[model samples]
Target chain A: MWDYTDKVKELFLHPKNAGDLENPDAVGEVGSIVCGDALKLSLQVDKESGKITDARFKTFGCASAIASSTALTELIKGKTLDEALKVTNNEIAEYLGGLPREKMHCSVMGQEALEAAVAHYRGEKPPEVEEGTIVCQCYGITDTKLKRVIKENDLHTVDDVTNFTKAGGGCGSCIPDIEKILKDLWDGKVAAESAKPGRKLTNIQKIAMIQEVIETEVRPLLEKDGGDVELVDVDRSKVIVSLRGSCTGCLMADVTLKNIEKKLKEHVSEDIIVEIE
Target chain B: MKIVYLDNNATTRVADEVREAMLPFFSDLYGNPSSMHTFGGQVHRKIEVARAQVAALINADPEEIIFTSCGTESDNSAIMGCLNSMPEKRHVITTRVEHPAVLNFCKTIGKRGYRVTLLPVDKLGRLDLDELDKAVTDDTAVVSIMYANNESGVIFPMGDIVNIVKSRGVLLHTDAVQVAGKIPVDVKKQPVDLVSLSGHKMHAAKGVGALYIKRGTRFSPYIIGGHQESGRRGGTENVASIIGFGKSAELAGNHLSAGNSKLIELRDKLEFGLSETCPEARTNGDTENRLPNTLNISFEYVEGEAILLRLNEFNICASSGSACTSGSLEPSHVLRAMGVPYTAIHGSIRFSLSRYTTDDDINKVLDVMPGIIKELRELSPFVK
Candidate 1:
């Protein structure tokens, strides 16, 4: 009951080119039994044209892993080595319509195997293989690869990184390390946000902006309606204010309240909510 | 496609007799058992009959049977109730391969500052009783073990476990969810303090179960709500499910006394056929000491979920202990605790039979299973 797409089920139940190639141009493998998913991918590259003539794969994994591997093998065949290398894990997952979020690492596994196989075909070192700092011991994911997955997938949380790179998915001992890394990454973003204009503002900047909007846009408009407001406090997204003068117990106080809320949202932040104290 | 179900350990079909017994309670005899009027008095009498019926299956007195919602509730009530009754005892002992109902609860208790000792099992899923003897200390409140494993269907030596735990003056509880109807589970023979059994594991409905609390055992109610179940359990009785459970117990008692020869014969034929055709396939548990109606096998180099999907194509229902099938990154804890090789662990399949299993069901599995293995093995990288 993993909610696998029809395409994923079809590929899993009947995988195309599911076998091991002997005496092939090159071969690659990623994952292991301990990681709960492993794949052995082989390529039959046309040496003269530098094109992949055929591809075969054997995977030991769940439904989505097998389906993703099968789809990757099918997607890369009859294409040039460069074109095949350009196939992303997201593209492979998309080829199968979709996969469950937690099973997205199976698609990442397909990407790793493809990179390793293409590197083997070219007689170069397999790029980004886990010789770097190990971050996730359970899945053998490294810091360098994990960072790239996070950046490319726009992952902001530990759970997001687990889905994209399989880091912290097993034993969960590395979850603190993953959280530290995410905190570091977001810390850098917070600093960059201070410099970037018209981007998401810092917390202090948001507070200042809220106060300025209330002083310039809200107070003048309320004073014109024979009602005045005073800013009381700003609690995260909430802007607390006190009704003074004619605004106190006024019949149209609700209308003024609605006007203040709408103006704050437009000028300062869309999530701002105004409340009369 | 006609289905051949071999996953009776997971859940059984509601028997016709059980269903028949349950129907009147859902409509005409719908009075609450706690009421005082004649309409309700008749329903209360039926509940008393049910208590006797459930107790008769295990040779316990009617007062010893405390009806609960499910196996998990019965287990929780047994372990947590024991801990509550003896708040001074700071230790608990259990085997490494108990169902999550007990295993996870023990883990939570460990987090709550209680010491827990998990005894290991051998490669054939047999316990070393000496380890159990040594692990028990004066602080131990209860040693909860299972009479039979659900994943591998390996039967544990209850007599030895009981003697060892009871000798130390520690309470002995057995999660007999898998062994109750499949084999003889009479409380009259074993002097264990508590035993938990599920109605669904037998042929009754899913919502009802019973716990056997020895007459002199110290206890506390898990749900401390009402004065129902003789102050042992709370809430209104699940009238229809309780009735179905009673009828299923009577039928299960009949099956046990008459001997489940048909079940054993079909199971043996299926096991022999699979073992003869495929040399790589090996059974996981002790062949002689395991349940007569269960067979767990692992075909090396072929993964379990793929094999299950293929078997499902043939309208055959079974279960696997493989990591992929369970959505966990690791395979079954029972298989892992027994030190089963990782190569075969990913491919393990469990086929559990029942009295309803027929020779034709055995024939379909034997005919189609070998080809599925061959097809998957052909695609496997390790097979070559």
Candidate 2:
């Protein structure tokens, strides 16, 4: 049903590096059995040369998933960590001759494991992805990862994002977020990048843009820190604000106030300053 | 490659006799039944004979049988037909495990300010009759339920459903596409208002289906054109398929009466062998009340798509609820509605048999399945 190539079938039937390394130099684990597929990739590298000596995987998934992990191990063998890091999921599917379109996420699982494993090889933690907003909770896909994937792949639809990263593929409660990310990438790519921040604006246009910046960018962070902010009034080059909840009496109130001011100036206009009423 | 097809519930191999009956209609008897000439009139007579045959299968009058394109059309016509007839009723009741034909249709109608109540089923895929009794109110328009589940082959107690619904004076429709031929379905014995059946499921050609509206049921046309099907359905009839369906329905009647020991035996053999040999393999659904031809099994620690692909190596045909198989992220809705555990849901595989299934087919599946399960389990992180 998956339209898997014979090479994929060959790799899946008799995976070359099917078991885990007992004392591997690096390990990468991505996905979960709960999501219906998971992959654990382990690598043994020559410490002096930084070349991968052996690569192995333990996968729980469909044919394409197993094939993807197996293809990943074969692709990275004898390659340096830097060289292996450049191998993408698309390349893994291509090396298998081809995989089904829907199974592209399996290849992504491989790429994620490879990245995590390479980070481990460097004695560094796999970059924790919770820094930004999570756009897809089903697979824990963050806004940062979502934007990077969209721009890299020129993805135009939520379904395209789903195929690449398994985002918006389950529960679908985050589809609005994925769609927002998609909208940002779809239109924001050409507009936001090319549009200069200091473009001339009427008082009304500047006020609307300031409000958009506050609601979209500034509010979420404040909410997470047990505080909330609202714009009481906006005058020419001066924004009046009220900080509610824990922020009203916090020891770091001045820091939080400057943070909001710096954010508004950087994102909206450098001339604008914040004042508490 | 020798294929052992156990996906009959998806579709059936057309019977040899049915094909033979349709040959003449496609070539020499290509006269349009709507024509006035003697050649065309004879074709109309044959269509009548076919209608009678289809009616006889369900014990309905020939006039009451309205032929349509397929089972989905029949289901749409029945449910939509009722709503169109009585615009005041705002609610439609159905089960959570219905085929997408009825479920999706209700969803669209729900968007149009219609309330849809999806009654839940037990872990065994059995609907609670008491819930149905309470859900029907003055606002309820139509209650649509399937005769037998396509995936599990578990039969619903339609008689009890009919009794409860009819007592409330509400209209009832049963989507009998999976049950009409595989089991006995006599509309005359029950007070049901409507029933739908597909030709292809009963070994007839595709592109043909029929709906039986018990005479005197409030009715309207869903197609809304031409006088074909007595103005109930539009467009010219699919002549060859209708005739083939008639011939197939007659054969199915005889086949049903004679019993389905081979189907039951082969189904049991396959179910028993796989569950016994494959460790952690278990069957889903109620084994006793299901159709004789269906056996759904799950191999714990091994996902379904892998098992199916491994089975494909031996040219064995089947289907699974694995997310990878359907390109969706969840298992089968039927299994989920029945509260099947998450551990087993992804690994569920459905092997539906037919009269065409042979002992050799069962043996081939049994021969290859354990190895397939073992091989996938070996690669699985959950297994070892």
Q: Candidate 1: how many backbone clashes?
A: 0
Q: Find the 10 residues in a row with the least total lDDT in model 1 chain A.
A: A190-199
Most DockQ-accurate candidate:
2
| Second chain TM-score for model 2 | 0.98
- TM-scores for chain B, in order? 0.99, 0.98
Residue A270 accuracy (lDDT) in model 1? 79
Q: Candidate 1, B160: how far from true, in Å?
A: 0.8
- Per-residue accuracy of model 1 over A1-277 as CA lDDT, tens digit each: 4788999889888889898777789898887876667888999999888888889998877778889988999899999989988898889889999888878888988988988898888888886564679988877788889887887677888878988777886777998899888868776776464432467878788778777777866787666544678888888888888998657755467877888889777777778888988
Q: After superposition, how far is residue A111 of candidate 2 from its true place, in Å?
A: 0.6
Q: Which ranges of candidate 1 are over 4 A from the true structure?
A: A187-277
What would the TM-score be for candidate 2 when compared with the true structure? Answer: 0.85
Alpha carbon deviation, residue B55, candidate 2 (Å): 1.3
Candidate 1 lDDT over residue span B101-184, tens digit each = 999888766754789999999999999999999999989999999999998889998988888888889999999999988889
